[model samples]
Target: MKPKKNPELEIGRNSSLYFAIGLNLMLFLSWQALEYKTYDKDFVAIDILNVDEELEEDIPIVNINTPPPPPPPPPVVVETITIVEDVEDVEETIIESTEANQNDAVEERIVDVSDVDVEEVDEDVEVPFAAIEDVPVFPGCEGEPRNKMKDCFQKKIQEHVVKNFRYPELATEMGIQGRVSVIFVIDSKGFTTKVRSRGPDKILEKEAERIISLLPKMTPGKQRGRSVKVSYAVPIFFKLQTS
Candidate 1:
């Protein structure tokens, strides 16, 4: 014998629509039950009948004839105070200045501060060539007198510049002739660094910079017995030779 369940199988095929319809019907029933409220019809009818009533006012008529107000009260009397001047003169008080007194203890009172911070100064910093106690020494400048070392250093620098001086072909061809200020810093390690040049033309400045950079390393400058950097500036003139 074959088993048949056509009614239950057909209901399960589209169960979602039926479930939605039941949910809507349940919501509608709940809303109707929650919205159900009863009011006292007779009490509301009684409140409508108890409206406020207008009262009739009693206005009294007065006579036009009236006696004028009583006259104002008498004016008050004020007694004036007259000051009596005395013929005797008042003595002036003179205050003597303390500047003539030598009170040293009061002037030199010590003030102690609670908190003080000590800062550490960098000792390896660079001093300029003029301010340095000992300048950078060239190879042969060591044998010179201590006082004459400064002169020897300048002389050696001039000699080195004369030997390496070369006119840039570009600058010469363009007729760019001007005095260039070439600045360079001799580091603590006695090496030339931070070479900068400024002049009327860039070509002249570049030439001056090349000459300064080619300088050989020397002994580092000393300030207070410690090695320091020295800044050096020189002016290089590029004069065109007119035939």
Candidate 2:
């Protein structure tokens, strides 16, 4: 089928001009409808001043001078009580040499010499048996020469042991026999003290100690002109006689 072209459709060709006219007309209507009113207003005042003739107010100032507060009272002084101690009764020792001439002044010094506490000395000094100048004088060895005193002392000790020798009953029964070593000290006071013994058997040692303890009080040995403690050792033999 063939389609027909209508001449009436050509009438819409000027519709663009209509659209432009409609748009301008709408713009003019909108502008006329807006409220644009005018009203009467009051004017604000603006002051005009000369810069050379300005006015300034004066501010009052006061000077203050007050005395400082008095210094704080002196601090309370606390007195300290000191206790006094009583003085001790101390004695001084003056050594006077008999042979010294009159011009020699004796030196004196304050010393706390406690003769009762001499044995309690802290340090023990050892005296050699051979180095003693004055050998400890046994009861009967006073008049003997110094060179033979040591020999005489040993002989006297042996004699004393023989006199006191009594074989321990238990040791003799058990046939326990040996040499016992006895050690003792002769103090500055010429008295025997600190007797100790060692042996193969206690019985023998006891006998040896008993004999040494019976030794007579002797003259204290002297070293360099001063009396000193002397140490001595003696050994005694014990034998079981066989029948």
Candidate 3:
């Protein structure tokens, strides 16, 4: 006799799989139910704005009275000119032309050199220290050779500056320090003049000029065997010593 149920076609063969799927579906549904949120219908409010029910505002109109423009300016009056007849006889003066024509002969005068007055104009000739044939001689540098006079002059100048250097009290207090360039001219009379200086500050410049002005009168420099003004420049240092 044939079996009522075949073992290969048993319904319980996939029972574990079906149980797992059903368990997973139940877990998902439980999680969704736990996360679900509900809002009260009474807590919600809906605002309905009726634009047609708005009140119309009427703005009051103000009338401004402006003053009328001023009256036009009065017309200008002109005086009438009258013609007057000359009762006395009038004589017209004629201007004679002084222009020379081809027929006119010009007088020639001879100029003699002896008759001509020659005014000698003493010109102020300035020669640079370097370009001068003879450099201004400092008092102590007279013993130096002519070839080495320039070096001696410079040495004497340095010595003089070192001896006469006095730091300005104001400049020192203000911490002003720099090199001041002093320019002065040794005139033909051997006197120092036109002493000017430029530096970082006016005080320094003034100090430098004072120092230059204190220089002793030197022997005037010569060019072409003639004494001339010699322009010389020196730099004075205003430095603060660091302790």
Candidate 4:
């Protein structure tokens, strides 16, 4: 037998629709509750000022007593000038010129070469090692040939440097090592002078200079058959050996 109640009006059929509407309404209420903000009741109270009431301030007036202006300056007195007449006669001075005129005779004197004194100035000439005609002779290298004198000189210099080279204690301890270029001048007297050195440190330079100063006296280099000063440069290397 068919049921008499209509299927469209059945309560169970509309239950899903009502449940969905109630779920949406519940979600909206939950969102509103989450979004609601609550302020603290312990807030600072601000006082409202009434614009109808006026504020009166009492300002005292001060009286300034200034000194009177200084009296006007006194009038300047003018002195009367008197005129005097000269009774004595004055003489005028005349300056005479000592300049020679065209009519004056000039005497001509002859200058003799014997009457004049000539001074001979000895100039100090410096010749470079490479450009010198004769290289300075070391004490032991005096027997070297003229053409081999340069090589002999260089060999002697190297031997001297090796014999006298001493590394500075300070430099060694501080690990300062470099090549020191020593520039020295061999004067006409064969003595080494004006020794200067440049290096990474002053200690190395001082050591190089000390070594150069110990060089033995040599025969002065010559240019044009005349003994002159010779300028030579040598580089002393400072190296630290690692074991």
Candidate 5:
């Protein structure tokens, strides 16, 4: 009365299950064959970046075996031709040369002296005697009882400057340094007359003249025991120490 079991149907199911498992295995092996591929070992060409288009440079070669050329020769010199003088002129020339030789012979003969006496002259030579005796004269002071005329002149000038001499203020400012040579004639009374600057600056000359003018009468210079007026030169120096 219950539902009957299907034995035939169960057998059929078992067979179908085994057949499905085998089919699944075959499908897996087919997929592995298609998915996992291997390549052949033949030579293959590969694509790469191209970069071989640049031009190459060439170098120049130099030769160092060549030698330099020789220099040019020097210039030639010509012989000079001289003209001969007339024979008559040459004869005259010989005669003149002979005459010159005779004159030279005479001079040589005169110079050669075996018989002549040679004496060494003494060192003493006679000096020229002047009628006038040289004496230092002082002017008006001729009879002033002064024996030292030169000394008096020097002293008088020195005294006059020492007492009243003042250096030129302008010259001192300008820095003038030199000796002024002044020539003056002393009268019989020792007064300076005709004062002139013989050398150097005009300013110095004027100052020297002023100085000589201020001097008193001096003893006159004497020549041969006579009181004679003398030309005296005095050198006045004006040197400024601080310019």
Candidate 6:
């Protein structure tokens, strides 16, 4: 049984028509779903809002800080002095000082400083004594007529030696060693005068004078048959050669 195929029911021809219909339906539904999702995400309810309504709301406020005022400047101080005394008292004090100085000068002038005199006192020089000499008994003194005066001279000379002669003990004790020479005039009256030192030591000279002063007057020396006062020299030796 093979039946004849209808033209209208051909699979190939009807398949095209069914496919177009399905495509149209699927497109329409997809479009409608996309529109719905877009509208839901973006839409707002403007009709429910009340723009004119006044409502109280709490708002937070932030306060800014201000620095405190600077400290006050330090105080300024001033001092005052009052001088009450007059200058006249100071002037009087100065005048009194000057007057005192002038009065002191006038008093000094009245003092007699110039009237004082310094007297010079003269000093007495003590003449030191002389040394005694050892002499041999003078020869012609005993034999001649002039020898009559010998005894008198001997006593007088002894007295003179005792009174005027001084030993030079200092030289001997001090170990002083030297020679002293003396020059003197033997007068006609047999006295030694003007005794003076002719040697180095003046200390010995004094000693030499003491010795010469004790000498018995010498017989006047004859020169050209005339008796004349003669100058004579004597040397005294002081030594410690023994020790």
- Put down candidate 4 lDDT per residue, 2-57, tens digits, no spaces: 77987567678789999999999999999999999998878968899878867789
CA RMSD per model (angstroms) = 27.5, 22.7, 13.2, 13.3, 17.4, 35.1
What lDDT, from 0 to 1, does candidate 4 have? 0.92
What TM-score, computed on C-alpha atoms, does each candidate reach?
0.50, 0.49, 0.59, 0.58, 0.37, 0.31
Give the best candidate by TM-score. 3
Q: Give the per-residue lDDT of model 3 (tens digit) for 184-225.
A: 999998999999888999999998898888889889999887
Clashing pairs for model 1 are 126-229
Model 5 lDDT per residue over 1-243, tens place? 899987667666588889999999999999999999777767666879889989988978877876777777887888899998767633344433334544454434454577879896533221111221333433433443444544654665666666766688877877766888877776544456778885466777788888877766655444545555566667777777753
Q: Model 1: number of clashes?
A: 1
TM-score of 6: 0.31
Candidate 1, residues 104-142: lDDT per residue as tens digits? 455575656755567878665767777778888877898
Question: In order, what lDDT does every prediction score?
Answer: 0.85, 0.87, 0.92, 0.92, 0.63, 0.57
TM-score, cand. 2 vs. native: 0.49
Q: Which run of 10 residues does model 1 get worst, by summed lDDT?
A: 42-51
Q: What's the residue-level lDDT of 145 in candidate 4?
A: 90
> If both were scored by lDDT, which would come out higher, candidate 3 or candidate 6?
3
Cα displacement (Å) at residue 203, model 4: 1.8
Q: Measured by TM-score, how close is model 3 to the native structure?
A: 0.59
TM-score-best of 3 and 5: 3
The segments of candidate 1 whose C-alpha lies over 4 angstroms from its true place after superposition are 1-124
The deviation in Å at residue 208 for candidate 4 is: 0.5
